[model samples]
Target: MLKLIVNNLKERKIGLHELNSEELTEALHYAVANQDFALQREIGNHFTHIYDQTDEIPYWFKSEYDDDVTIINFGQRDKVVDWSSVTLEDCLPLTHSKHKPLLNGFKNWLLAVSDPLENGGAVIKTSTVKMRVEKVLSLIDAILLRSAALQLSLYHLSHITCDFWLSLFKAMSENGPINGVYDFTGRTVELVKAHVKSITQEQVNAFASKYPFVIRDIAEDDLTLHLAKQERVKACCWLYSQGYYKYGSSFIATGNGAVLAILLFEGKIASPSLNTPTSTELWLTEKERSTEYRPFNTENSKTSTAEATINTYISMAKLINTNIFKDNASSPSIEATKALSVRKINDLVILKPAGRTQTLHPDVVFKLTRQSFEFVLKFQQDILDA
Candidate 1:
């Protein structure tokens, strides 16, 4: 029956999409029974393609593969969480039914576990747990909306496999909807291990770093580290202020604008050359070598946290004030902006404070720093043009 249909499709006597769910199911079973995995895969692919073109998956097709396929076929009336519209209240279980937790017993188990070194044997904060849960849900919602997976459920610790965790991590990393959350692929292993609940160590070790969770608790003593990170950011600002830029096809592709500069500032890597790549060259390089794109080696920008982001920006502002404004100017205050806004006014750049939960590019803070203003203007018009 399947062979006859395939021949019909080849002869253009019948459309692949025109096959009913019963026919497709029989084809799927026939392919599987005959150990023809390639045929089964092609059938799934064609199913997806049909849905994509029509914006509707056949009801029978959805019923058969709802759990097996990546693209979810949610009913029109079924409620789906919208991360963009989420508020503190929307995250509350009492307020929203779809606002579900990722792991079932992990939170309670983690709370029971004690950390003698921190918070007088308290392992984590209630507020921090709430935030992490919200974040994880947001990520799941984003993944679901993009049809990354059908009916993804991380709620049952026993049901989740190592492959599921890795696939989830990969999806989060590649998906555009959750880039604001963190560099999911870049720093997945650490974050996943950090948020491990009641799951056994052996199970956690199975993934070998590709676990799950954006649920790592923020350390109580993070202020000290924040101060040190700020100093490094300050050094980066100083480099930009001095008109020194690092560009190379190899190293430059490792991270985003700010991360590259920070790596250069720390002397962890050496500068490629004094010559900066032109904007056109930069664009071409990004297009050509996307795999080596932006290495996020540092812990600061790898995790999703407002403190790391705000600290870097504040440090940049402070550096600008000290270097250019004689440490007395209020125009470039050390305050993290309440709003993420940037605009240029002649030689000076006006930047507003980033939100408490905001994540921003370090280059924005560096370029908009009062001290780096003249250099950026000159670099743009003269250096690149020439």
Candidate 2:
């Protein structure tokens, strides 16, 4: 039994027998502080028998002994008592009203049993029982610390649902400290964060309606878009940043007046993509015949139709220039009135648009590329010149 106990403690990195007298005493002090009366009583009994018989106490005792005691008792009178029969309540100091005795009789009893000079009229050598007692005491100390760690793990688990907490508790109890319970908790938290709950199409439509520029040209069939692994990770991080955990989607607004409706999808998806067109492209395409793409109320501007069209072209050019050279140091200046010039290049019209002060890089703004702006402008110009 002692060999088994030593092996168990060694497995946990607790070198009980190897500790010096001072270190062993300190370890015993820690165990006493934790109020593990059951282990204390077991250790006390083992050493008491060793001292009483004047026999050498082995490092480990093989047989088990029944020394169970209830931790509750009240209004006990001071009298001659058998230390062996003393309950946990008898050892505890009277810090509360229920406990009548102010003195810790159990601690006194343990000291007397382990001390060679004090053991009841027994001529037992201190050296004979000291090592055995220290080993047992050290084991008790380790058990107390493990028990506290288990309680702390349970406390953290309490934050989750009761069912989950119970399930985790059972798992820990069965195969505990094998893979750290705390590590298991961290993994559980990550799993919860990655859990993407599905939302109805109605919810998706409502979100799209609120941010038309962000959710532009989303195909009817593509309403249920699945997220890629990288996208899912980003979505999870974004959701956490927003102080939300339930919703697996968000409408990320960009600098260039565009909103991106990001949604997280469950399970693996093959070639997952956001099949949505830009609002600017769609707007430019629809107003190809109009002099200016923007609705020009005659009341809002005194500029002529031709001037408005030129101004609109300039604005589109600036937008495109902004997308292309947004990160470049020596980008061209964007004009407010008109594009620098529009020239025909084979089947395509090359608009020499100036760069804007406020550029929209593709990385900064989701899906707003230089090519997108160029495509819209070229298409619009072709229809107008036709």
Global fold similarity of model 1 (TM-score): 0.19
Per-model CA lDDT versus the true structure: 0.34, 0.31
The residue pairs that clash in candidate 2, if any, are 2-60, 214-259
* Weakest lDDT window of 10 consecutive positions for candidate 1: 267-276
Which stretches in model 1 have alpha-carbon errors above 4 Å?
Answer: 10-12, 50-386
Q: Which candidate is the best by lDDT?
A: 1
Off by over 4 Å in 2: 1-170, 173-180, 183-187, 190-232, 235-386
Q: What local lDDT score does residue 26 receive in model 1, on the 0 to 100 scale?
A: 79
Worst 10 residues of 2 by lDDT: 263-272
